[model samples]
Target: MATEVSSRLFYHFLGALKRTHSFSNFSFPLGLPQTSMSYSASKTWISPQTKELETWTKIRDSIMRISPRSPFIPKTFADWLEHRLAIKEDQLRKVVRKIARISGRDDRQETTIHPVLGVKEIEDRRALVLARETIWRQSLESFPGRRLAPWPSYEEYKHEGDDRSKSGYRRFLPLPRDPGNVTVNWKQRKPLPQYLFDEVGRRTTVDNEEDKEPGLDELLAMEFVGASLILLLDS
Candidate 1:
C-alpha cells in the first residue's frame, strides 16, 4: 500500500515537475532520466514507512538550509522545487503546538492526533490526502486487475519513527473511525476521469507489467512529488 501510494504520488509529481520545468533548471537531476523510480526492496532495504519519513526529513531540512525565512510562491518548476525544499524548523515546531492544542495533550506525551486530518489544518492536509487517493484510484483504473496495495492512513505515518521516547518522539491523534471501516469499498470506488487517465498514460508507462518496476523518469518524478506532498500536508 505504501509503495502504491508513493508511486502514484510520484506519477503526479512528475507531471507537476515537468510543468514547472524542474528538471531543466537543475544542473543535474536527482535521478537519471532512464533510472527506475518504482519501489524495490533491492534498491533500498528500509521499510516504506521509515523511508518516507526519512525522505520528508531530508527534503525539509535541505530546503530550510537553502531557502529564506519568507519564501516566494514558485512560478516555475525550479521555483517550486526551491520553494518546496525551503522549510523552516519553526514551522515544524508550530505544527507541534497546533497538534498539542487540538488534542489537549502535552507536547511531551505521545499523541494519536492525525497531523493532516484535524480541523485546524484541514484544508491543505485534506487536499493532500485526496490528491493521493485520486492518483491511486486512477492508477487502479488504468491497469485493471493489478494487485496494488492499499494506501496507509495519515495517522499511521504520523509517528513513523517514534519509539515512545520523551525527548525526540512525537505522536498524533488517531482517525475517527473503526480501522476496519477505513478500507475502501472496491465496488463503490471511483476511477480517474477518462481524460486524465489518457493524459497520464500518454505521459508515462503507468500500465506496466505487474512484476516490472517503473522506469527511471517515473521514479524521479515521484521522489520530488512525494516529498512535496509531505511538506504540503505538513504545512
Candidate 2:
C-alpha cells in the first residue's frame, strides 16, 4: 500500500516537471520504458526523485496528523498544530463537530456529561428502615419456587408381602411434603452518622459497647464500601 502511494506521487511529480525547466535534467525520454534504460541511467533519475518524494510524504503526514482520519495523532501535537496555524476556538469547535457527525465520533469535551454525585443524608429513621425492609422483601420474594427439602432415604424390603402398602419406594423420596418458604431475620443496626467522617469515627471507636470496633485498615475499607453502597442505593 505504501509503495503504491509513493510510486503514484513520484509519477505525479514527474508529470508536473514536464511544464518546468527542470525536465531536461531527467536524462531519459518520458515515452521510453524504464526497463529499456541502463541501471546507471535509471538510478540517476529515480534516486533523487525518490528522496524528494519521501521528504514531501513526511511533510504531508505531519499535516495529516491534525486530520480526524489519522488514528494515532497525539493531543499535544494537535494542540500545537492549531496554535501554529492561529486557528480560532470557534473554527476548531466547528471542525470537531463536523468530524464527529461524519465519523460518528464522541469527543469527550462536547459529548460527555459526567453525572453530579450528591449524597442526601437520610434524616428520617423510619424511611431508612422501610427501605431496608423493602429491599429484603424483594430479594426474598424474587425466587418464588425455591424451597428447603429433606434428604432422600432408602431401606431394603424383606419380602414382596412386606410391601403391603407399596410405601417402600416412598422412603427413597423426600420425607417432607410441605415447601418451606424463605425468611430474613434482619438485625437492627444503630444509625449511621449524618456526616461521613463521623460515621468512620464511630465505626472505629473501641469505646462503643453496642458494636464491635474494627481495625484501622478494616474501618477504612468498610467506610469506602459503605459510601459506595449508600450512593448505589440512593441512586
Among all candidates shown, the one with the greatest TM-score: 1
- The residue ranges of model 1 lying beyond 4 angstroms of the native Cα positions read 1-4, 12-18, 29-235
The estimated TM-scores of all candidates read: 0.15, 0.12
lDDT of 1 by residue, 1-235 (tens): 6445544454444434323322322232234233345665344233333333344445555667777364553333334333333333334567678888989956697867775335543222112532432333312332343233345454344444343334476654332222233355432344323323223434445565775665545554666679677567769
**Clashing residue pairs found in predicted model 2:** none
In model 2, the Cα lDDT at residue 56 comes to 42
lDDT value for candidate 1?
A: 0.42
Candidate No. with top lDDT: 1
CA lDDT of each prediction against the hidden true structure: 0.42, 0.40
